[model samples]
Target: MRLLALDRFTWRRIYWILLVFLVILITVWWQPNRTFPTGGSLARDSANPQQVKGAIQPIPLSVDLDVEKVALGEELFRDKRLSADNQVSCLSCHHFKRGGADRQTYSVGSGGVPGDINALTVFNAGFNFRFNWNGAYETLEDQIQATLQNPKAMGSQWNEVVEELQATPEYPKLFARAYADGLTAENIKDAIATYIKSLYTPNSRFDQYLKGDEQALTPDEKAGYQLFQDYGCISCHQGMNIGGNMFQRFGVIGDYFDPKDGITQADLGYYNVTKDEADRYVFRVPSLRNVALTAPYMHNGSVETLEEMVKIVAKAQLGRTLSEGDTDLIVQFLKTLTGEYLGGSLEKLALDSDDDITS
Candidate 1:
């Protein structure tokens, strides 16, 4: 009996020792292999293909979509008849030449009324987990419907919009080609959203660097990218879209709004939607893709220059004061994010006038 007891104790001790060893092994393995939220697996270094690093992934060059739907949707996107006054269209605010956003602090709405918030870029918007600054809509279709009905936007009833489109000589034919349903409100919204999804701008220099092109980025820009990761900017902005994957408070470290300026309803952010006090000033993190072309910055468009915006965001969000030299380097890295759209660089397209754009 004594010998049997001794054997039992010895076996139990060995089992516990193995269990502890397994736990340690797992901890060590997971620590290195674990991925950040929305970040891709570590990529190989451009210079040394064997060395793995980086979290950001390249945007896909193209997405498969129905060509007929895309063509019909593009027409609707530019059509003024969708608005109540027949003066505003989606393109009025989302300009292809201007990085898919109008370069205005507040977009001029249908009757010359300014909007409550800055217009986010339409390019790469489909990559976002949710739509709008407050995340009020879950799907692109929902956002489109709301925008159409919103008094400050298109301001048109769905019935009227459908009727007008059905009456238009070209729209019926376009709708028939895109959908068998032909000119329903649902089909119209779907077509428009489909086209918006096709607006992704890919093949940026940064994407080339990610895909193992050593010469894509300058030495300073590469250093800036390293600094971006080291400084924890990647925590919220480390996805294919570089942002738009998460919601974060505008000011994580300190108060960003001025008391004297007075808070508007728009400043309430998700709080207006949820009516929860905790949600105040919380917003969907805007994508940094093509950010250099779409300025002024922030939800309110308070910061005019990209450099000034970077300084403000660093101080408010990261609680760090960046040196002038560091700021310049980071800005240079950001500029490399501007990508190709419609077989042309967005920077080159921005120089084209509205007339040229329509032509």
Candidate 2:
């Protein structure tokens, strides 16, 4: 009688159990379909994983830039008066003549203190999804504010800087031209951001080559380009600027953590902002534009030479070792990405000297 009663109880719960099973089974079976474009050169066998699955269609570059903002942005970019000291301008670290970089392992800030990482070039930074090596700032304006306020960088508080600017006669007029209101922290940030957005250098030899100008790249450069794609460098380093669109870990193939090296406190990369464990050591991939001039590669400025950078990349990303010759070719190809600054007449903003300020 007890067995008969237990059988009935089992049968009563059978429908409930089946319903739960079906829900779980459906969830397991249904995978969301995602799509992306195949990237890199037509001559090479380059295709994204999405392309392999035939879930995405290829799309060409299509977007018009605001020329007025870019023109105004160029002027504001060269203005040294943006800094409290007037000695440390945006161009001070990213000089136009020097391939938009200081070429130092680390940049010297206002008080002669070194920044943690090598200063990235300003060129095509607008193309990046996020700003900074660790992907800390979301926009150029945000980075500008952080840079200005950081004691190591500009070493000036917002209120004090504003008061100084208010005292200056030209700043009020410049602010009027740039923005309607005279000078505020928010407006200053917006104006600076507006100028940075205009700093794109789209036309390059590689761009011409992509547009079917076969002679744009030399024979060696063409070979190097092929090797770059074939060797799987383009998997992460792709898109309009060759890189700077995504984030990846420092040591993907090998464990970056060395207990002996005292690399305590997990870097956590974008995770600090998002709180995702997957973002550890991941950073915004830098633009290859003016790459030849921007030395001391990587987030911590670890790899000094481009050849070492290539080797490290090959080992960490590709999971393969690269020859010295192969590294040289890759470096040579990178050199082609350097574009000339179009803005010739960047007016440097003048500030009153100590005598002028007091007088």
| Candidate 1 residue spans exceeding 4 A from truth | 1-54, 354-359
**RMSD to the hidden true structure, all candidates:** 4.9, 8.6
Reference-based TM-score of each model: 0.86, 0.75
What residue pairs are clashing in model 1? Answer: none
Give the Cα lDDT of each candidate.
0.84, 0.66
**lDDT tens per residue, model 1, 36-143:** 322222122223323225557899988999999999899999998999889999998899888899888988777776688999899999888899988888999999
Candidate maximizing TM-score: 1
lDDT of 1 at 178: 77
Task: Encode model 2's per-residue lDDT on 266-315: one tens digit a residue.
Answer: 24566666777877667666667667666778665667888888888777
- Top lDDT: which candidate number? 1
Can you give the lDDT of residue 11 in candidate 1? 100
